[model samples]
Target: MKRTTLSIALLSTVMLLTGCGEESNQTSNTATTQSVEKEPAQKACYDVGETTSFERKDVTGPRCQWRSEHNFIVYSEDLSKPEYPGTLPVKPGYAVRRAKEWPREDLSDASSYDKPRIQFWWNNVSSRDPLVNDYENGYKIWSVKIDGTDLRLVTDDMPSTASPQTFMMSRSPNNRYVAYAYSYGEPLIKAIFDLKTQQTIQLGSARTKPYLVWADDSSYIYFSDGFKRYKYTLATGIKEEVDVPLSENTVIVDGKLINAAGLGVGVYDAKTLKRLYTILPEKEFEDSVDIEKRIYRQIAISPNGKYVWGINSYRKVLINVEDKTWLAFSKEGDEKKVYDKVVNISNNGRETQVGAAIITIKHYGSDYRYELTGKGRQSWKVIQSGQNTITPVLYNADANDGRFLEIENDE
Candidate 1:
């Protein structure tokens, strides 16, 4: 009886060991399945037959779409080469622009002494009606030598009737040419002035302001004609419509023209005009109590193309480019603070001096006061300031100088 009992116990132990081996095998097979599922799929460089659209990697849905029918062609920056084929010849002296009446000594004191000079009709003094009165009193475009030696009036004919409306000035990306836009009357005119030959080609009648952008110095010129964006070749006289509407306040970077569009921001191939991706606005802030209560006034793109500075009716916000994160500038009494407006981002973006005037607000009361307060940098020194019924109370502040450019009525 004892022998039979011992044999039964041994058989039971063998069965238990066999069951444990099967369980171990099942766990190993389950782990292998999970490891295969966790691996990410490889992505292709280029997708075939893909429609041009902007897709924010952080957001869902087709946020923005571009039609090829709208004279939109996408150029790959990789494929687009410089216009001037050979090595660019170095010029000895720098280019400069100054007023003819201004002394060469005074020109040296101007802030833009180092930059190549191009002339614009500007008032000698900051006034309430600088544009209206100054241009009518015989102000014309001028060019100044870089060394502050020569100053010559570019346009011989000064308008006797109305002020010449100067819109914008830009040097070509390749530094081959200089372009400016001016409005004579109803129709706007753009002139591409060739510095090499000292000749000007008047490209007439644009719907809105003509934005002259360059892919390179000698090869191509990009402009938006209100309806569409066009690239004109100086050598071949070939003008082609691109595949997407170029965004406002766009800059060429990494072979792509990134634009600030209505929906969000988009990146397009500067050569092929193909839309790469659209960065969508953060949705979390859409439902915020503060943002919803106040009206958003202006948005400024940083010079370095890293952050976006936006001013609302109530407050200011800074947005990060890479992470789609935002921080709002808040002011309470004499103390100023910056808080995270959007989630998932640390409040670490720094403020810099913005060149252009983004927006202006007016307050009319006994408590009316303009105060410039930020963490690190102060306001820019005011170039000019004045107050009138027509003009908003001008309080110009410069980042370099800590003084206010305050204008009080002599009346």
Candidate 2:
């Protein structure tokens, strides 16, 4: 069945009415209870099977489907590689949308920085099968430089699955190891791959596809299989059962886990798994609507780890990790404008303030870019506009030069 698309404003209005809200800089000592309601049956996802002619008016199907796997084209920005302006022509048949973070330009070692590498998932389909077949085939982790040289396979252990959407892969911060899993309908397998050692350490299978997160220091890996949490230490080669603030929808930054706890949000010590504080919606959302919308279902953390943002269907909250302050916004225009991503960039324009960092905000539709600094938010010009699912590569805050990898859904 075709996926349904809702306007951002309409979706935000629905979310604001049925979901919790967070604003200002206040936080709570504990989490509050808020019941969440599912969208009306008319908006739910359901299989239309071979009958593709029927429209939504005649069917009460799902608002969304289980997965919407699509082809991903690679793109990059490197002054050394002028060949890659829009899309980097990769040999892989299909690429995963989750492109691991590219390393910042290392002024110390200009050689390595000039040849930045990007790791992503690519399908290794068999020659016998149709080249453009569905995902129920094979996948392998691979990496290539911005100029398309040094193409190497990260791993080939990914299981053949009908549902590539269920697979999860995470690259460590230090760029040494990759934690990957094939969840499928049930938990199948999970493991860690050492890029240097070229060794695969199986972390054991999960009853469900487990969530994988790496510590800020790259010392340990935390994962939860819905029932219990486990921490895997890298140096000791030890896997121990431990309680962590890990959840299906949590991101760890600066040794802290930003957890989406029902209608509210929580910050916890990633190492100790102890709750540091709880962020609750303002009185307006908490008392106004008791229903939930799975607040903060998605999280994006800045490279510097100083800022993190949580996004639900339409509402989003940006939190300043160091100050413990936050700002809430939605697409409805009642609050601050919602931004989908936040990244740190050096303010090169001001040579005296070279050390100063500028926060770049990429809007949801990839239509506009904005820079948020201590003063306020302002427009940041960018070349790639009117395109959706555009991931920045070597993203420059000045808007003078940058590379964007665009993912177009192939129907």
Candidate 3:
């Protein structure tokens, strides 16, 4: 909801594939007349020049791990940090743009293992008012490295009258492709990008609530708009709706899907849409809670599609996909449950480690406890000190469960 000046390092000679510098650069670039049947030439990755230093925002935003090896931040501050006096990452957000309530940036590691990169969105619009950002245009998708070089712009060619907004991304298991969705006024902008070539293809649109899942080989892109699931074959360009029933709390893994409907957790074959396994909540908790009537939301699946975590307003469920096992547990009687969130996922999409935060708000202060849970052959939990509310709710859980990397320097 808020816009800010982004300070990225190493962009002295970065080529602008689709620039948004000048006020008039909002013109749609072949996005309107483009036909879905035609395939564009694969674009070589943005040609980046020498590395440069920057001194932009003083306050850093959330930091994301790229390939679980490097860090990228979406910071915002009052000052602008320039490398060569004029080179800036993006225009700075006006101090007046700050609002009491607005959505913060939600970034995902959209990097391909072969070519390290991270994906995030830019909302130039500061308000719902048409005048804030040209209501006709402005929103965009971007990718950069953990080292802050090779800043490439995706989501060009947006129709001038059509606003390409509300983007959700799902990187393929192979890490070569990212399939995402955005609505252009009507229908939907369901597209996939080949990170290597920097080329994106629009397959089709969705009418209802749309969720995306990519095939392991990057050969197919699947999306469900609540009613039915559709599979679009990359080679054939054929998009056919499949007979898949979906609720709001379901997510598709590579070859399987995890759904928390009825009174149990259901696993299905993604290809054949066949039920593979079902896990009911433990009998001890079943007496107090009605799984059949409970609505599970905020479901988070690990990058490898091996572990599934789901939560209703009050309860939580953890599912081990490989073994078809699950656990449904919640805090005991009258316990204060302030917040919970999934922080860091595995870099290589394994069950090695996943990070999360469990919080309890007290009269004096809030308690922030971080957890790094291990799944698969190795299983353990390394915890962070949760003495006070000052503890950051999110932890960048790498192989080390790095603590200092994101900690602010009080000195």
Candidate 4:
């Protein structure tokens, strides 16, 4: 019973993990590479100075700093507000580079926790191609806190030919390590970066870019090279083969298996394998439109298995497993179907409050915010009266925190 890596096309459907920046004072540092077998050839490394900080004193546009007493729903714009001078700051670099179609940022893994950090690929060169520029060479991984204070170089040994869009990363719950993978030209390669030591441990290559998932305690990491699954122990440096069948587009919580495929998703009891709820996307496009455009991807289930969220060809979405209601962010749609109208919703049946959620909304030509506690849609609570919408390129979900990272809608 070998656990095979599920071929989840969530990222493929939507182009994920692209980065852009102007030019900054690039410092060169040698990266310490540790390989399981023969060590990789030593190469020049890149480093960000300890003095480099994007902290802004007067953040009049939008707020990017975390609020200790804020609502559950945290937006990327809000998180980047305190640090970023503008929506796309190209002066000091490290800000998202946008294209004419969409704001092009390294939509990789952006943290949502208290000390959230974001990781991305940067080449010290200032050129914006659709993917990685051909002339670029200094490909490296860099990370910084949301407030842009602690900037550190994760690794500078990324293959020059590696596609930036193919880059995928996940930070461990403990924030000690970052597991990342990307394709150089053909087959994919994966590795773990030590945040504390500022070094890298290169795992073997994978046929496909394997997904990185860390254990709750951050004891072990799970990934597949498209054929065999592996569990790498952080302390012992032991990589063991494992047989755990998992669907990339699904999650199991409280004995419930939630799977999102094609145009719909289903929730089933893991033991009985019986479906409990079937959620489908709203009918937004005309019937003559291609059905593939309506397919759902990046599906996520809440820790309690009560709710699910994802994105499709058009917009981000959400669903209540119990009610089987699929919600979409829309300008003109049904009151129940429009997630824009959803003030807040959270359910904790056993405890006094299981969870709480809020959505920044637009009502009657004004801004509003609300938090729902599973009792029903509550009254509009204006925690922040006027909020600006910044285009979000990446989202990282911290299941333990009961909240996911978000960016305001560009619309």
- Those runs of model 3 whose alpha carbons end farther than 4 Å from true positions after fitting are 1-118, 124-137, 144-152, 160-167, 196-199, 245-255, 258-264, 282-293, 326-339, 347-411
For residue 366, model 2's alpha carbon misses the true position, in angstroms, by: 17
Between candidates 2 and 3, the one scoring higher on lDDT is 2
TM-score of each: 0.46, 0.52, 0.50, 0.45
* lDDT string, candidate 1, 60-178, tens digits: 12311122211111211221124322111221111111233333323224453333332434322223322334432344444432212233334423343334444455455443355
lDDT of 1 at 246: 48
Can you rank all candidates by TM-score, best first?
2, 3, 1, 4
TM-score of 4: 0.45
RMSD per model, one decimal: 29.2, 28.1, 22.4, 26.4
What's the C-alpha lDDT at position 113 in model 3? 21
lDDT of 2 by residue, 76-124 (tens): 2222223322333332111222222212223243244233344444443
Better of 1 and 4 by TM-score: 1
Query: What is candidate 3's lDDT per residue for 1-411, written digit by digit as tens?
Result: 123223232242243432434323544434544543466542221101111214322332332112111112222222223222222223211111111122222234433122333444443233332224342124444443322233334444445344433324566655556666667667876778765565788766766666666665668767775367788887898989876655434556556776655444678887787988776654456667665446554555544455555566566666666766665555444332322433222332222122211211111111111122111111111111111111111112222332111111211
| Model 4 lDDT per residue over 1-411, tens place | 223323345444334432112112121111223223485642311112211234422222222232222111112232234332222221121222111221122323343334334454554333332222433334555554332323344555566566543324666656677777767767677888776576688876867546665665667777777788787888999999875443444445556666655666777765566778677764546475577767654554433456555556666566667677654554343433333322112222111111111122211111111222222221221112111111111112333242222222211
Lowest summed-lDDT stretch of 10 residues in model 1?
Answer: 387-396
Point out where model 1 deviates above 4 Å: 1-98, 101-168, 174-176, 216-218, 287-296, 313-315, 322-325, 331-411
